[model samples]
Target: MSTACPSNPRKRDRESSPAEQWRNLARTVPATLMHIGTSSSVKAIRSTKNAKSAMKAAKRSGDLSPAGKPDASGSSWPPEAVELLQQARDDVSIGLKALRDTRDAIVVEFFDAWKVLNQNR
Candidate 1:
């Protein structure tokens, strides 16, 4: 005699193999890494804040050498480079917010996947 599959949609979903469940959950890894990258970039920017401030202060104080050239005695980012760093910091802050929102999304997705995979057991 031929056997029949379960008619319940939920039962069919729960029947997915463990490897399939793992592959489903693995999709969250890239999002997690993006979050980590944002956090690291923010932290790095914060750590350099003092140096950036010092450079700004020096520039404002006319520490430039004759002919309006930067003093060779110390190193600092060029104006364009500084602007780019500022842009990066702004972008990282926005990315961090987005990643924070996605954090909850990933967790809920993982829990749902786990529930589905374990429901049949």
Candidate 2:
């Protein structure tokens, strides 16, 4: 004779598997990157105050060398940082395009539905 308990087995106590963890992280990274990019862009724009103010500051502080040149003496911001900023800008642009497309599609769908309903009536 064989005996088996009817109760369900206890939930497995385990961390996510490596692949699962990686997938989860991958999903989160884009959102985090987008947030960081948007924040940096906002900061950059805000820091400029007005274009005139920024130009004046740069000119007065000698950040711009003679003849309105950017000085090479300062450390270059990391290439990765610049790349990320560009990616963020592109992502935002794509997102806006997607939103517009979706809105247009929905409007068309709604109008089509209304036409169908009117025809049926």
Candidate 3:
């Protein structure tokens, strides 16, 4: 992250600027937690916000829900939050694979049609 956002040192550097020890408490805590056994990252905040905004827009346009209600019944889903999260992840994985397969099929069909036309000519 530091390498990717070299220009945006938004987080206070804890290791660097050793001279700041005198006013360590005065400085805000650095957000470089990824290195310290925590995969929690600052970049995920932006991604979460972006996804929320996109879903909000989709909902408003009636794309996500025409009735503006929950898509599924809670009874059908797992009661535990962890299980629900895993189910959602699996849904996304399956959707992505299906979309990729559809795109590949379309491309193959187009290429095959072009090849047959050339052969006939």
Q: Where is model 3 poorest over a 10-residue stretch in terms of lDDT?
A: 28-37
Name the TM-score of candidate 1. Answer: 0.34
Q: Clashes in model 1: which pairs? A: none
> What C-alpha lDDT does candidate 2 achieve relative to the native structure?
0.50
Per-residue lDDT of model 3, residues 49-111, tens digit only: 444554455344443333454345533322343343444455455545545554565566556
Best by TM-score: 2
Question: In candidate 1, what are the lDDT values of residues 26-88, reduced to their tens digit?
Answer: 776556656655665566556456446644654654444344655454345356544544655
Scored by lDDT, the top model is 1
Ordered list by lDDT, greatest first: 1, 2, 3
Pairs of residues clashing in candidate 2: none
Task: Give per-model TM-scores.
Answer: 0.34, 0.37, 0.35
Query: In model 1, which range of ten residues has the least summed lDDT?
Result: 58-67
Q: Between prediction 1 and prediction 2, which has the larger TM-score?
A: 2
Each model's C-alpha lDDT? 0.57, 0.50, 0.42
